[model samples]
Target: MIVFNEDGCIKCGACQGTCPTSTITVTPTYIQHCDMCGQDPKCAEVCPEGALKVEMFTVDENALDQPRLTFNSSLCTSCGKCEEVCPQETCVVVGKPNMEVEGFCVMCKKCVEICPVQVIGIPGIVEPKDCAIDLEGKGATYIVNCVGCGTCVEPCPVDAITLDKVGGTISIDENVCIKCGVCSQTCPWNAVFISEKYPVKREKDIIDFAFDSTSCIGCNTCVEACPGNFIKTIGSNLTIEVPDICAACGLCVKVCPTDSLDLVVKWGEAHPADAEGLGYDAEKCEFIGACANKCPTEAIRVVTKTGMACPSLVQTDEDPSFVNCIRCGACAAVCPEGALTVGSIEKMIDGKLVMRDRIEFNPSKCTKCGDCETACPYNMIHLTDDEKLPVKGFCTLCGQCIEACPEHALYDK
Candidate 1:
């Protein structure tokens, strides 16, 4: 039998997991004595404090790789404190009740600190839990201290939000809320926000932004108006790097006097480093009009120039309008040529529909084939040898050039 120093043991459960024979048991408060493995016991070898040991025996220098965290079902009261604190989505500890620390675990150890019964433990490292995950870039739309102003009520496509006028509070019906973030976008008081959450490491999608630097009047309006401070004046030109942290509020887009900047926001996703940089182009479009036929709102129109395919909105007898686009991503989803991409995809999460409210264009994917130039009804776009397809002033910024390109390179951002 092996001896356990009760005074020195921290109950981290490292030894029990490291035991080669599975002869050791550990709990939050106590550890069962080991059988010593009849030699230099692995349990004693891994014990952080040398609390477990055989009489007059010295263990080997090398330690075996073991599970970083161990669970004691007997000690777990289903208190749900571990799931509340852990940042990883892979290791869910509440509903599933298993902290499988693989793939996504960054070893932040938030569960260790919040466990009420001290049931959660990290072996070998007895140090305090790390608070090092950078969470500024990840978040979801949340309403804080809503004043029931009703500013956000009219813009909501679905009646998922409500205002309690008497109580001066806003309540969102999670069952009905589409998570489109229109309420978060329309809130004037900045009460409804994409508030920060625990940092879960995810493969981020980049933001699509466009700035017409040639037409820029060197005005400082955008730099001063930006609330996120993402836009700055670089020499005589304006440069903006809107990454994941941007709130997608469109303040800078509204403030720019020259109409130089265009940003079609994909709320709650990361933006790319350069808006004009590379885009996802592995998929090509045959322009067979599937996206046009798939559009529920009749918003997409397919046209071909010299066998090159592009997408545009079906023209109505009335004014040019894309206000009907629900952003269902049906066009993008059905496109065999892979020409169209929606701002986001609709997902069901916690019984609520999380949908993309807009679509963004990417320019790096442009092939410079003059398809957009030929497709331009007003003939505003010109393909220069030294530059990408540059649009001239008095441009309508329509979807024509976007639809004309076979490569799907131009973005309306």
Candidate 2:
């Protein structure tokens, strides 16, 4: 028989699962009682304490010597006086009708007579319950805090999950959910659930993005912005491939200058990081569009007050001296808020102009042999860089393709 010693119990709640007959139950404090399993006790075997022994019956007088807690289920009103009287901290003897007992119940019997209704058995064994397994991933909740990071969506093996934005509703299709528990496990916010009870359908974390081929310009900024490296093109094919890691972070959508990228933030319900080295203080933001220029991932963006999606919104620091804040005022020149000021930084950038299909280029340096054709993702340039991921006329002057150009043949001029 499995005997529960209240003193040795840590109240970890590890014992309350997967029992066949529902013989055992648990409260937050301790195992309520043992069903004995016809003399075979699972809780005793599972207990961290070797507290249970093979006694033919629980009536042996020695059972009282080890110190135990008992509760008369008929009389207990669950008013917490036993929990307050214990010298040990509250983890033991903590629950009222569901009491917790720490190491050993000193056996003082103070609890025996203290019950106003006389419900708590002097040293009571403890609570009961619905033993259920959720066949559907019904435990998921449409949280008020979905970030659309795509972390949860990527790990789901069955692809049964869907999600929307923060403050949006979400639902796991109970009919389709395989109940693998992947969404609840991967959620950083603890927002997704795989409960026995399905949370109501609210806005889901359904964010989607699309690539526009007509105005694509083959810039590959989206490629660079993608953390998963999910964007790729085999040859000069006009068709672009976006992979499953698409979480609609707006990293790529904000950087597309020709309005070639669109991010649909919320649509329907769906299944779904720690963003490192990232901080945004909105009051100081001036919508410069320079940070978007400087951002490696374009994670930070300026959203206009009119609610129109502006790819331009525009990081931080103590002079921990990690960032290149020369105080050059280059940002000041570009700040629409005029929040920043500069003294004397010089260099009139010779900007490139659009010619016909692409940027104006020096014909003497270009053979027009299509060597750079693959380098231009949009096929606008017949000859281009080899090291870079192929650019769209070097619009942002990110210097990736130009720096990697081996022959100095591709120039922004």
* TM-score for each predicted model, relative to the true structure: 0.24, 0.20
- What is the Cα-based lDDT of residue 70 in candidate 1? 33
- Stretches of candidate 1 off by over 4 Å are 1-154, 158-190, 193-207, 236-245, 267-413
RMSD per model, one decimal: 22.6, 25.5
- Candidate 2 scores a C-alpha RMSD against the true structure in Å of 25.5
lDDT of 2 by residue, 235-331 (tens): 5865456543233345456555677777664423332201111223334444434443443322223333343222322233212111111121122
Stretches of candidate 2 exceeding 4 Å from the true structure = 1-277, 296-413
Candidate 1 local lDDT, residue 359 = 36
lDDT of 2: 0.35
Per-residue lDDT of 344-381 in model 1, one digit per residue for the tens? 44544457665423433334554555443342222323
Pairs in steric clash, model 1 = 206-272, 207-271, 207-272, 262-413, 284-337, 285-337, 310-403, 311-403, 365-409, 366-409
The per-candidate count of clashes, in order, stands at 10, 44
Best by lDDT: 1
